[model samples]
Structures are given as structure tokens and as C-alpha cells.
Target: MTNDAPLVPRRVLLRTAAVLGAAVTTRLLTAGPAAAPGGPAPSAGPPSAAGPSAATPVRPDHRLRPLAGHAAAEGRRRLPTPVRTRPVLRMPGAGHPMVLTFDDGPDPRYTPPILDLLRRHHVRATFFVCGEMAEHQGGLLRRMVDEGHVIGNHSWSHPLLTRASTAVVRAELERTSEAVERAVGQHPQWMRAPYGAWNRRVFRLGAELGMDAFAWTVDSLDWTEPGTRTIIDRVLNGAGPGVIVLAHDAGGDRSQTVTALRTYLPRLLADGHRFTVPVRGEV
Candidate 1:
């Protein structure tokens, strides 16, 4: 079972609130010149299931925004038990396989290039997208589906779910799910709470919505604009069986993430490691 303790320290959460909110606002307000006027949202396409698995993966990090204190406590109290719940920290028995995931994305500038790199390497990854982002860049979502990447719901606007009411939480998840469904023809079956601040309510809601909770086993800390080598080393030094490496495509300048991926992705593959996304079914 995943630990019931808070994923982020109380002090850290308190300290970073203003900064995170600003970043989110700045990202939306200045993401890239209003999508070129009437560029058009893409039509729906078939969504990918990939395959089923008994184990699931998830991630959280100090670099993410804070979770409200009371909410954080409640969330920790509600975490699912180790054997049956999908995420606590790691995916048990899934082997030296690694899952690479990007959150808060579909940013046209960075995501497209990141997608190109993944395509070049023929690597499949999961993208945990925020609804606002997908709504703004549906084409990117469509391209993700078209290219055989897994899309998971990250929430409507990247709010801390534990702090919101049940209705708000549902709306956050459902709205995003609907947006992704519109883009890719099916709702996502997996979810990762923003900042990994999941509470019992989140788990229940996610299960009700047919999702298995997942958190990353490893965080690259790339959002901090850490050097490329640092990010690469964080992923490489920490990687092991059933590890999920957390990264972001849109939270900020992800050039370091892009470069780090270019350096470490192939290296991981060359070192006899395989990448996989958690599929919906049988878990």
C-alpha cells in the first residue's frame, strides 16, 4: 500500500503557493499567441488502450505546487491500501520497465518538439494533460492519439483536488476527461492528481470514474529548470524496475527536459530498458 503521509512537506507547500499560481496563470495568458486565430480543433480519433496491467505507476515532487494543509492531511488519511490500490509510490512486480510521463502539457511550442523526439526514438509514453491545455491545443492531443501515445487526465486547470469540494473535483476531472474524449474519441481511464495531493475522496472519485490512481516513482525535477545533465542524472541514477519518471511538457521552459530526454532516453533503451504506459483494463 502507498504511504498515507503527505507527499510534499507542509512548509514547502506553504512557501510555493504564490509562485505556482503565477506560473499557471502566466502559462495560459502567454502560451503562444491565441492559437493562430481560427486554426481549428481536430476531430476525434480512436483512443489507444495499449494493454492491461496489474500494477500501476505514479509520481509527485517537491517542485510541484503546494497542496492545502487540511486537504493534504485528509488526502494522506484516505490513501488506498498497498495491495489493492494502484499508487502509493511504486508499481510492484512490474520489472525493470520504466514509464515516462509528461504533465500540464500540449503546449504547441514545446510539446510538438517533444513529440518529434519521442517519434524519432519510437518510444511510447503517457501524457497526463490538464483540461485547459488540451482545450487550447486539441490538435496536440489529437496528434498524441494519432501517434499512439497514452493520454491520462490531470484535471481541469491543475487545481489541488483535496482542497476542493466533491462536485468541484468531479468537474475538474470530468471536464478534462470530456475534453480528451472530444479530441481522441474516448475518456481517459487513468488520472494523476496535480501535485500528487490525492485524498480518499480522489481515489473514490477516480475509481468511480474508471481510473486507477498513479504517482511517479521518480521525479526528474526538470520543472525547476535544473540543468540538462542534472535532469538526466536524476532519471538515470534513480531508474530501476517499474519506475515512473515524472516530467512536464508545459509547466515551464522544458528545453532541459527535451535535451535530457534526447540524451537519456536512447541511453536507457540501449541499456536494455523498455518503456511502457499503464493501459486501462483488468486492474
Candidate 2:
């Protein structure tokens, strides 16, 4: 059993709304009527479980919708520009650097091997660990810190943000941060919203808690379990300086993720790309 507590703060609700607005705006600008509901002809590839498929009803989850008009308000409250700071959207400056981040993990079945492979390659990556998962696997959490890997908060139960109340989000983050601190003796400095979902509230609360909000630049989409080759292709094609690549160590059978890493890590290293973590005062 896990500790039951309210996770998110009041500010997070507003912040989450803002981030969602940006995402929805981008989608509307780029998407066509064919991509809209009941307006499209069939395209190639497997029927998408999350995509438009006539066989399945594709109702958007109302709970996941971003709060309206929150973006403008957040824009007014943006953080002050700092001197001598790294650009928020630029890549890191450490020789074709890229960040590899794993979410919802510390699984005994998968995490150990992932950690071992990282060790073998002399690389460091970030693990956004679920509190529930880490609480039960404290040793893994300890190992992550001991081995110089960065651990981040990935919420407790991994609920979709649109469905959770502000309080719920705060609880998810705080409890997970507490768990990481207890196990590793230091609090997390970073967090990634579940499902790439972000809003004003999520960003505000994370910043208030002294964490930098991180989103991926390249999504391996490993969660879909595309074959190992597909996963490798996505990462290699997307590789670049300062790119944050998202993958998962748990949340399902991750055999393909494990296999793909074995192929790409060595290749990336040989290609002169150095794996790194986000430095403090950099984000």
C-alpha cells in the first residue's frame, strides 16, 4: 500500500491549463480536417489505438482537456530572464550531448539491466521514478543515486493530468519527491508530466517545489512497443545536441526498450555523442 495524500498545489491547476493551451493551439494550426473526427479517409499502417480509426470511438477524454485561456495569464507571470544562463530550448554544449530519460520505472525486471548497460557505457541518464514503484524498490533508488544517475519525480499513481484535481497532482509529486529523498537522501530537482501533459498549474507547482519542468524533445514512443528496430530508428534519426529523449524502463514489458538501448548506446557513444544529465542552474 502507498501513502494517500493530496499531490498537487492550487497553482499547478492554472499552469497546467496554460501548457495545454499551447499544445492545443499547435495541433489546431498544423492539423487538417482529414485528421479531425469523422472527416478522414483511411491511411496506411496498423489501426491506431489512440489514433483515428472508424472501428473505435475516438472521443477525447474531457478530463484531459487543458483549461481555457490560461496561457496568456501564465505568459504574464513568466520567470525573469537570468544572466549567463543556458538557453531553455537549445541543446547542451558537451559534444553532441543528449539526455536519455526513463519514466515510471525502477522495475526489478528491467531497471537493473538498464542501469548495468548505462554503467558499461560510462553514461549517465535520468530516471523519473514513480513513488509507488520506488517505495517498494528502495534499493534501486539508492543505486541510481550512488551510481551518479539523476532521479526525478514521475508522480505516484501515474494518472492522466486532466482527470486529477490540483490537490491530487500536488500529492503525486510531493509524495514521490519525499520517497526519492528518503531513499536517496536528496530531493528531485526535475519532473516530467505523465503523457507529456503539462499546464500552468503543473509548471508552477513544480517550480515552486524547486524543480525544473522537463519535457522530451524526441519521444521514442517505446510505450507502443514498436519493434526494437523501429525504436532504434526513431532515436538515431532524432539524435542531436541538447535533445531530451524519452523512453520507459517500466509500465509494461520493456524487452524491446532494453534491446534497443543495447544497440543505440554504443553507437551513439562511438559517434561522439556524450550522454549527460541536466546541470543545476542550467534550466
Please report the candidate that would top lDDT against the real structure: 1
* Candidate 2 lDDT score at position 3: 16
lDDT of 1 by residue, 1-283 (tens): 2211233452243224324444544575578764332232333222222322324322212111111222112222323423224363554564635778998776665788888987777666789988777775666665675565677888877777889999999999989887876665556767888888888888888777766787888888887776999999999998887788888887666789899999998898788676666543322
Q: Could you tell me which 10 consecutive residues in candidate 1 have the lowest summed lDDT? A: 58-67
Task: List per-prediction Cα lDDT, in the order shown.
Answer: 0.66, 0.64
Please give the lDDT score for candidate 1.
0.66
Quickly count the clashes in candidate 2. 22
Judged by TM-score, which candidate is best?
Answer: 1
TM-score of each model, in listed order: 0.71, 0.68
What are the per-residue Cα lDDT tens digits for candidate 2 across 1-283?
A: 1111123531243234334433543464368542222111122222221122212222323111121122112222323322221113334454436789998777766788999998777667789887777765656666675455678787876766646788998899889888776665566777777766667777766666656777678888886788999999999998877788889887766889999999998998778676666645555
Quote the RMSD, in angstroms, for model 2.
20.8
Which runs in model 1 stand beyond 4 Å of their true positions?
1-88, 94-96
